[model samples]
Target: MRTSRAGTSHTVLWAGWAALAAGAVLCVIGWYGVSGERFAERQLPYLASCTVPGAALIVAAAVLLAHGRDATAAARVEELYALLVAAEPPREEAEGERPVAGELVAVPGGTLFHRADCPLVAGKAEAGPVDEHGRAGLDPCPVCAPDV
Candidate 1:
């Protein structure tokens, strides 16, 4: 079974947060070694090294989280594109289609209007775009609400 994009995104976010927590702990330990009266003076050099790598880990984690968000957005767009392609009517009916009517897609028995790429419109018959004056009774899809 393939993992969902949302699941992957959450995993990345959690990893980033773990790295940040680890970095904070390392920095605190390093600071304690350098400032505590109980720590020997000679131990300062070794403990100080922890803070540098801890800071680096925090930065790396932030970068990973940012990329994860970008990837999720890209995945959504790709899914939308696929839905649009599948919902398009066969070419024979498109030969005489009006220019304004080709922009949107809807189901035959549904009461909602949707953008051509809306996932809800997938596998539904195309009713073309909503008429500018005939949209009084139809509701916009909550997921991919078309700007009717």
Candidate 2:
């Protein structure tokens, strides 16, 4: 589903690029026509038929390309945010077993243990109370070393 959305964005970007290229070609043709003409009356048909439409296409292509890029960036941000939320442990578990003051804490996969009040673990979503078994392989945090 996400890939499909990304594909649509890519399609829009490609369409915009194609439009830009076509516009440039049309403008070039108009310029060529005007350059070969001797009188202003002879050049008027080329200006009316090609130059004005070409400029409009270029402007529309720019807007389309910008919108496509913005959509792609927004999708990427949402996907990353979802992954971050999923990686976090459930709040209910942390709520049921809150760590007391001076207790050792560490994130699920972290190698270091820290004091409950340590700045490193303060706002971490995955940080939880580390029991004796949990503390076995973990090293004390240098930033806020917990007394064993």
Candidate 3:
């Protein structure tokens, strides 16, 4: 058997993590430089030969640049998903409420309901809604769409 791992957000997350790692390394180098003289005697031969603050600043800049890009990517993804769902038009449920357009399943007493539209089948799921009293209630699965 073979396996392939990919998802809509995987690329974005990879890019983010890669950038984060690079930035972290840069920050470490930069901080080392800014604190050079304080630990000159403990410095590595090659490291002692370089400008600490300069190295540190470069690292810090790399980190910041990567961090900025990562955040931008994440925000863009959210915007896209929002736009997709928004553009699809609203659905009306029999309850006179907007139908939960996500995935649904069976509850135990009736059916476990969840709010996702994934194609893969799933097991009983907890209700994603919260009541005013701060308690969660299991509602009808949208596909099976049982009454509460």
On lDDT, the leading prediction is: 2
Ranking by TM-score: 2, 1, 3
What TM-score would each prediction reach against the true structure?
Answer: 0.48, 0.65, 0.28
> Whole-model lDDT, candidate 1?
0.70
lDDT of each: 0.70, 0.86, 0.47
**In the order shown, what is each candidate's alpha-carbon RMSD?**
10.5, 6.0, 14.5
Could you give candidate 3's per-residue lDDT for residues 94-121 as a string of tens digits?
A: 4433224442432334424444342222
Give the alpha carbon lDDT tens digit for every residue of 29-101 in model 1.
7777667646577666747687777787789789878977877776677778778888957544454553233
Q: Is 1 or 3 the stronger prediction by lDDT?
A: 1
Residue-wise lDDT of candidate 2 within 1-148, one digit each (tens)?
2856677889999999999998999899999999999999999999999998888889989998998998799778878887888796644445556666678889998999999889887766678888899999999999997898
Residue-level error in angstroms, candidate 2, position 128:
14
- Assess candidate 2 and give its TM-score to the true structure: 0.65
Better by lDDT, candidate 2 or 1: 2
Name the lDDT of candidate 2: 0.86
